[model samples]
Target: MTYCVGMKLDKGLVLMSDTRTNSGVDNISVFRKMFTWQVPGERIITLMTAGNLATTQAVISQLEERTKEPDERDNILLKTPTMFQVATEIGNLMRNIIGERQEANGVKGRGRFTASIIVAGQIKGMEPRLFMVYPEGNFIEASLDTPFFQIGETKYGRPIIIRGYDKQMSLEDGVKLLMVSFDSTLKANLSVGLPIDVQVIGRDEYEASHEHRISHDDSYFSAISAGWGDALKNAFHSLPDYSFYRGDD
Candidate 1:
């Protein structure tokens, strides 16, 4: 399992993904789930994946190969004029990968290699876009009402994003919000471990403007984890307690 989050802000996009993958309690290992492609001053794209590792890796490998071996194959990832088409191409690749795997493995393989992806980027002269692409090759864009997307162990961290996100917030604030959300999930789940990767793409920047990796011993993350724990304790204690019966005393 994994926990990957991508947020769309009025300023730009912020993405974070855990590097943890586990086959068993003693078999845990780290693997990066975030991939980015960019042509400075023209376009930039970032993808965060969750689900079966093999399927996700295959999809990424194919995309990476196409970009590098453009003479032998079309590099739609770079040549596409719109982000929508970029997403369309990726969705097609994911669908093809899953279909082929299932076909080769027989009926027992259905749904075994499914994966999900969040795609975000900007093209010159066009507004920044964010999308959550399903395993079925369909996707939906982020809008004002839904300004972010989460994949993997999303349930544990979703409330923080729902409560704290504001489109007008600064990029720095956006990063802090995501860190807290990831911290919460880390505390509640074992599969979503650290050495988390973060990327920020400022609107119209045409590339990632900032990138950071949060390691297990990262002082700032440790502080955030501890401080948030204390804050939650304080908040819980401050709430009024309810009486079981009116006028019982």
Candidate 2:
């Protein structure tokens, strides 16, 4: 399906998502899973999505529409005073969309219409925050105890992050950690193919300090992938040999 991660670091935030969607082995497509909204120096918001493409696209479209027609209704993204409020609004919208689709399709649509999102951003006068919104309109924020969140095909990549994430690390290191995580995921799962989208937001900047699209041929990613594999193999070999059979041998 997809792989999206949002990290809350001391400096700011780092977000990344893969762009591959597949209906079947023969039917595959690429659609960006990352979306961003900004008000220059005032605020910056980023959303990374997973699960049903239709549901996520509809949620984003509705949010954008509200921003354009603020006179007709409250533009939650623009009017919210804090990042917490922004997450609340997005959670409500996503829950409503999924509920409506399920109701329209009746029981036949049970599990087909669900989706989840990672919301990360900052508003003027506030610190950067990160959230993982569930399909049920509930969410959890990242804290010192858990400084990151990953959605969609998460298992294969989670260990790398758990072992490497450091809240005090620089954005550069954050990106490198994410690349290793993503590379591990890509090798194990075909559904998470890349052309990854990445964004780095610096504290107080209220704008993306760096944005990149990494394709399969990217030199740096290639090096990371190869280097990680070699390191893993070396570590496995360097472990002390088993002593259980030493007497028999």
Candidate 3:
């Protein structure tokens, strides 16, 4: 399992995904969940995956292959005319991969070969966009009402993003918000973990403004984790106490 978030902001787009994948407590592993395609000043596309590792890797490898052989008709990640089209092409690719695996595995593959992706980026002349692509090949774009998208082991950290996200927040704040959300998930679940991958795209820049990884020993993330725990405890203590008796208020 994993946790990945793609957020749409007034400044542009911010994305982060954890690297942990595990079949059981004894079989934990870390593999990068984020993949990016950039054409310098013309466009930049980022994708994060969660689900069956094989399926996700297949999807990415196919994409990489297309980029290498740009003459290939299906080379759309870089060739797609719009961010929306990019989402469509990716959804189709994932759906096809799952379908193929399921057909090959028969009953055994009923639910085994599935995955979801969060894709975010911009094309030079078009507006920056963010999308969540599902195994079914359908997707939803982020907007004012739902300004962010999360996939995989999402429950533990979602509320944090809901409470802190602001469409106009700066990329710096967005990163902080993701750090807190990821820290919360790490503490609650072993399936989602450290060495997170993050990317920030500034509006109209047609490229990534910031991209980096948060390692296990990153001092800033450590501070945020400790600080949040203390703040939560203080907030809980400061809340008005309830009384067992009716007159105690």
Candidate 2 displacement at residue 14 in angstroms: 1.0
> Lowest lDDT 10-mer window, candidate 1?
66-75
Q: Write the per-residue lDDT of candidate 1 for residues 30-69, one digit (tens) a residue.
A: 9999998888999998899998899999998888674565
Question: Model 3 RMSD to the real structure?
Answer: 2.3
lDDT of 2 by residue, 119-140 (tens): 9999999999999999989999
How do all models score by TM-score? 0.93, 0.92, 0.93
Report the C-alpha lDDT of model 3 over 188-224, residue by residue, as the tens digit: 9988888899899999988889988999889999999
- Selected candidate, larger TM-score, 2 vs 3: 3
> Global CA lDDT of candidate 2, please?
0.92
Candidate 3 local lDDT, residue 151: 92
Runs in model 2 lying further than 4 Å from the true structure:
66-75, 108-110, 246-249
Residue 91 error, candidate 3, Å: 0.9
Local lDDT at 141 for model 1: 97
| Stretches > 4 Å off in candidate 3 | 66-75, 108-110, 247-249
lDDT of 1 at 85: 93
